[model samples]
Target: MHVLWRGDTLQRLRLVSGLILFTFAATHFINHSLGLISVDWMHEMQKWRWVVTRSWPGTIVLLAALLTHASLGLYKLAGRATLRLPRWELVQILLGISIPFLLLPHIINTRIAHVFFNVNDIYVYELAKLWPASAIIQSLLLVIVWVHGCMGIHFWMRLYPAYRRIFPLLLTLAVIIPLSALGGFAVAGSNVAAAIEIPSVFANLKVLTRWPDAAASESLAWLRNLARIEFGAVLAVIFGCIAWTYFARVAGPKVTVAYTSGPTVRVPQGPTLLEISRMSRVPHASVCGGRARCSTCRVRIERGSYGLPPPVFPEVVTLGSIGAPPNVRLACQIRPEHYLIVTRLLKSETAGPEDIAIEEADSAGVEKTLAVMFVDLRDFTRLSEKRLPFDVVYVLNEFFGVVGAAITEHGGWIDKFLGDGLLAVFGQRDGVEAGCRQALRTARDVDLALDHINAKLEAELGRPLAVGIGIDAGPLLVGRIGYGESVDFTVIGNPVNVASRLESLTKERDVQLIMSRGVVRMTGWIPPAALTDQVSVRGVAEPVGIIMVKRGRELPADVLALRAEEKEKEKPAAWTAGFWGRR
Candidate 1:
């Protein structure tokens, strides 16, 4: 005997079954729209409907889908960590569960009526059965069922890039189909009512009254009662399951889950961290609503994970697919039985629908504004030419250590090291303003750090070492560049090219640090109006304005005053976002 409880399999089964049900619902809605032409046209469409839904093959598939979708839904419901979800998700769940109850009466009157009582429920007979109360009930079911299916399709398709493009057109179709069906049905009802009042005009009136015999009418009545009783029983069971789950949780041990986001939540042992977050009203990222289909709710276990429950098959699959580290786990799946400390990987405060789109775009390669900085070790080759190879390596190591600390302290990421220098970038995590600000700060820090390094290494080097730096901030193509194994994540464009060229310009211009005009504008920085000059960059079409820092880290008293004024004018607290918004 073989049984599979894999999370991916279960998820795929749920999707397939739900889609099957949606297909049937779509066909029924389309058939209802045929009433716009004539009630006769609707009746004509019923022949195909019967062949599709009433035939043995169609009946098997429809019933299988209903049973499979419903059972899996309830199974998922019982195992859920928390009932609290986003509004749309909650509404979709309620509508999905309500489908069977709403469809019970209508199904009993039509297909069940046809099978047991041998009654043909055409538009006339169906129209009579749906006059006052039943009509409103059916109308509610139509909207609920249609909207439920559409929502499922939406959540499924939203992850796809192309889906966003055609969504408005799809939304228009979804609106038009249902509204047209209601209008057509209302118009058909008026015509049927007018005919009913005057029987002399229509000779054959079999469609008006479906109850040909007392036995058939009695059987139909019995089926209606049975359907209602079944609906009541289902409601009782669902509510009962919910109550049992609540009490079962109440009896379980309590667990404390600590977050890096400054909150510690205590919940019953049964629920996951996501459930705890929702129950405690803490904002946590779970874009897939804790289905384990997304890594948004991933957290690193900081402490007390030894006593926590191991990942189940579904959770294991999700974590494995994302190439998650052993220390990291999805908060939606981990049900801690003891105290646990966890740090959420994604920002809960800023993560939203927009973030999801941005993440997708990044994976597909997109342009972003970044601050690029190039560092060149000046006079190193001339000094190293006189030293031993071992002494040269030692000096290079000292220089790298000094500048590396400075770069990291100012929030710069070293992309790669050139033989004698390194290229660093800022704003991979933060936005333009912060990145630009950090780059300028690093230039100052590196100059100071090198002074300390040179003083300590007076024996290894005859004189003090100096480095030339060039920085520029602007929009660039940031993505994975290269093929397969040789691929590298890099930011490339005019900004990067100009910055590299400016580093070379540093020695020619006899300046310790230089920057393109764009960096100053981006940081809202006002450098002193000193001997600012223009230099033609190699790849650029025109000459670019340059900010020359002649005295290294030492700015004149006037330049310092202007910097203070710029800081007062544009405080970072007052201006957080630059172009794409601070990440």
Candidate 2:
């Protein structure tokens, strides 16, 4: 049997199933908490059970879905070549194993008993006995199962840009939900115990008072039988869906396509080239599934660009940001409208550190470039340590927001955030003069923001904050770099490094902003008072000229006068020394 291994599709299935299971488990926990209110509330849950199970078709569908999900999970586990999995994977496996064991007995005791023995007193008798003794076990199963499923969903959602911001919030909710459910369960258990002691009170409950007589009515019996049949049909439909998807994958048409480097043969009409590549035994990287959220699967259309559809929205956004060639596309987003030839740019199955780092090096080798800016936060480590985790996060967000806004406003793109620093490139999208002016304007804006941030923090935390910035202009290499699974577009070479180093010197020089002579010469917009001679840097053999910038909406007249007076005093001292020597 030719088993089609649609890894991407299978991953997506796992994501969907995991999300469904998580949502269901969350609701189940909340329902269990209702037990805290009173046994009647718990007993009321049976009504919904009937609704969920009333359609035989729905029950059958759920049963099949559960079975297929479990089977696929097992298949994935067994197919793994390496025993060394990630810590999260191990956690998932352990939880997966425990769930069925804990849940199976509960399912058999309730659903199976009702189906075969006509025993419907699940809420009153069975749950009371099992829950008290196995409360810890049940809670454990609930936590593990829900967490496992939630983690899977979180992993999948990380692949999309829109969902990235919500990832942490979703994870936080996952933890909060289980705790709330457990609290409710405790309350319900106590209520159930109390009600059990008062038989008179319990007998008056609606479910018991309206108990169905076994031989009472043919209509009631017919309804019960119909409900069971409907439940079975539900299960059947779910099974059919899984079966159809599997058959479709296996029976799909196969095609051979030539890659720039080689050839791969696989089922045609896949949602992505990565899917086809994986099935064909061609090595490919999909760090974030095939969502086109990450550029790990970037490939150039060598000879068959016309055979593919125009780039999708995601592909266009990601590729455009990274300045990819018009023919370049993400393998995960490209579906073959026709036979095609492609060349993978990044040549590794896993993302490596060199992917981003090497790209910077490559960009620095370019001939003519625009502007580069380096921003370093002042005393970030000290500030971070003084604050709580949440506070630190808030502060960093604020800092990044301000700097990012400035960069983007001036038509520049951020290369990367280096801990407490920021590196940005200008001119690749526009022209050289525009890039230079943008960098300068961004520096001035940053100074303005720092004043505002410091004022706010001073009021809130009784402290001030500062940052130092540097701008430089030069020719450098700029391009994307990475092997198969990881890649980024960044600037590289000495100019980029020097810009960073210049920012570092600002603290000792007492300058809020500094620009290299290269920038002043290229832009020809240097202020006369701001210009300074070559200053010694740590590494380079020669000194580099710079322009020191002071904060303030405009340079203070008094501060300028003080500088002039100091220069005058120095000249008088030199003259007096010369006169004394002559005498």
Tell me the alpha-carbon RMSD of every candidate.
13.8, 17.8
Q: Which predicted model would earn the best TM-score?
A: 1
Most lDDT-accurate candidate: 1
Question: Any residue pairs clashing in model 1, and if so which?
Answer: none
What TM-score, over all chains together, does every model reach?
Answer: 0.64, 0.47
Whole-model lDDT per candidate: 0.73, 0.63
Q: Distance (Å) between predicted and true CA of 98, model 2?
A: 1.9
C-alpha displacement of 265 in model 1, angstroms?
Answer: 2.0
lDDT tens digits, residue span 444-520, model 2: 77778877777767676566778888887777776555533244455676668778888887898887777787776
Global local distance difference test of model 1: 0.73
lDDT of 1 by residue, 419-529 (tens): 899888777555676777777777877888877888898756778887889888888875444432233455678888888888988898888888888877766657777
